[model samples]
Target: MGDAPTQQVPGLGDVVGYLDSPTAVCGQRLSVHLSSTVGPTRVRLRALRIGDYQGRGSRLVWQSGAVTARQQHEVEPAGPDRVITERWPVATTIAVDVSWPPGMYLIEIAPLAGGQPSFIPLVVRTSGAHSPYLVVASDLTWLAYNRYGGRSLYFGPGSNHTQSVANRSYVASTDRPVDASGQRTVFKMTLPLVRFLARHGISYDITTDSSLDATPAQLVGQTTVLIDGHSEYWTKRMYDAAVQARDGGTNFAFLGANEIYWQGRIERDARERPTALTVYRQAGLDRLARADPATTTVQWRHAPLLRDPAALVGVGMSVVGVHGAYVVNTAPAWLLAGTNLHKGSVLDLAFGNEVDAQEPPGPHSPANLQVILHGTAMAAGRTKPSLVTAAYYNAPSGAGVFAAGTTYWLCELDSTCPGGPTPRATSGALEQITLNLLRAFAVPRAGRLHPSAATPYESPAWLAKRLPVGGAATGEGQ
Candidate 1:
């Protein structure tokens, strides 16, 4: 309110643009400018509400002035532009700073004196300036016991012997807080990572349970990728959506183990909340045939895609267990840049440490696949093959398709084994390889920066030549 200002601080257009910016980081500061015809007696800044639009309904995420005694809120004055910079404490700022998962959110800014609130529509993204908009599809229908059947890590109260195995493993807990309001734990670990990345700058979207049918066209705004996390079961629409995204220049990261093994259908209630229905079996090949005949199968043995020939020596489909101990492997590669490992060293086990091995190429294998990491036989002896494969196939749209072999291993980047330990030699190598693949197809703004000089391993131009004609090797499941 200085010198007959031409603009008002709480003008509708100003607030609209501030909220409309495509990029906004949580810890970053936002300065709002205002003007007034005459200097008001006094001025103050406060958050009004955080809201969103879903279908035809409006939802409120937060309200203003509803602070607890322990929460703190304050306002600061900016320069003569009559700008009032509102400073919200980190903890209490959740109302203003909070990101609405992967969905759409509508934020409103209102004048304390009761003027109409300005609406800003925002899509919270994950980190990375050019990071792809990652959509995490978690199939909760088939919650594997333990981490891939070793000690029931994802199921319940239990323990593992190996340090690497235990550290990266997720044990089903009766006490651990469940995600999405105690409905599932898979979302719990995954959602936090999503939020963390979004707060840092990465853009992402999420579809869970029955929301899997959100469609590939709906995800058009996304540029780079899609993620399949520990997705044991998937509905037909979900599968189609992933396929469409991949063909449309949207790369993929399979961050879970034994993905696409089972087929699921969505059962929605009146409110549209989804409940997943699924079927599982010891023999994935048979199960796949029963579920979806069009699905392809993976080749666990003697396949050009596998990176390490030793790991698949005995294990397949399911893993019995894994030891999380560091071993010597390629370190100068780009993926290991920031990692402290040099030569023979140890790192944390990422996932599927000890698992029930099943036949190689267990089920639903895609064409033009590549194997990045191969699981080595542990002391328990590698019995069956646990194949972690990646493939590039030609979709109906004429674009190539890239599909991962194993899902769980990809998620191990920040996870620990169930034994409260470190990764063994072979598993550690797998973790590094997984990181490389994700980074390659991630947002693609810049290659991952390493503190020290690192060599880039570019994808081979003749990859198409290496792939089998007509598609992947058929009927070679182990």
Candidate 2:
């Protein structure tokens, strides 16, 4: 190329940055290494702000904005070349000192040299009584959701006519706060849940789509495991991190559903504009196979070939639509320990409310696997295979993998009508079963513990007695 076009080039976002130390103990000194292009004149590091995206009406606003500690630095001179490095001390106030709960944070950097500000999404994690550290990585692209701002992975504008019309007329109701109970977006539900956990003295960390590369060393200080609401996306790095943590004695629990299906590879332009993130689906299995066969394989999909196939339900694919009626088939597994169900007969325990036109099942179905619930399968209208639910245990690492058949079931616990606010006939029993399994998996064999403490929260017998009974509703059992 003769010469590159001169324009207002954007710098890297929050997720792309270096840190002085990868791990930090409680109340210790930590420094973050930040680099950016030196455009023409001196590029000065301005203020850093942290906030969450809120508001409605097509545009999002950062509801909370607070300035971080100030850092002033200059670029190193190198023969008309442009690039600078700066280090800022991270004390307790800036989130390195105190025990930062597990979760993702959006870090934004403003430049004084006049350009669009850059953001770096950081994933901070801690293991049980160990050190906590930050990990920098690229954002996972193509993962779909209802309210996270990008295109809906499953239910989009054209996915359903009624939904498309409603979305157009959808307005954020000021009467109800974004964090209110009946909110629509997964993030809305997740934010409050995080608040609830913090109030109850639960320690945790958050990793976002960008910082999916957070290593096991950064998560060794956490005790309880937590996955945010409707976290349906995953990359090879994310899968490896979680698997390693679980195998190494870290307690784990997925608060959401349909996780680790669509894989993405992070891509950044020379200007770090985040040009495009590529998605990869397996051969004969992508959503667009009907449109083009040559585009379905890993090479065309652009995502790293996932080595661990068990991490997904439909052989590393997405679960589309809802139509089946999921009942609590078994009420006696370790997942349902406290929920004392005597024998047979559990009902109305379906997860993932929004139903899509389902499709065929995957080829590698586990025969010996116990069916927790049963329901009708829908025809995959325009999407790929319809994965109802699946579970697998990695032989070598012994890490248990559970994939909800549908994405709507991601929020099986949210109390609401239609799906029902309170637990259904066997919903409580099912919840207890899940809790039991998680607890069992968390504790080591030598130090295993019960699903619940001294007195369990809800008894299985009590739940069975309170089960709801009636004829099936319209979409009860598709």
Positional deviation of 379 in candidate 2, in angstroms?
5.6
Candidate 1 local lDDT, 263-316, one digit each (tens): 434444474433223222222423344454433222222122232211211112
lDDT of 2: 0.35
After TM-score superposition, the amount by which residue 425's alpha carbon in candidate 2 deviates from its true location, in angstroms, is 4.6
TM-score of 1: 0.44
Give the TM-scores of the predictions, in the order they appear. Answer: 0.44, 0.49
Q: What is the lDDT of residue 273 in candidate 2?
A: 26
Give the top-scoring candidate (TM-score): 2
- Please state the error at residue 146 of candidate 2 in Å: 7.8
Index of the highest-lDDT prediction: 2
Report backbone clashes per prediction. Answer: 86, 43
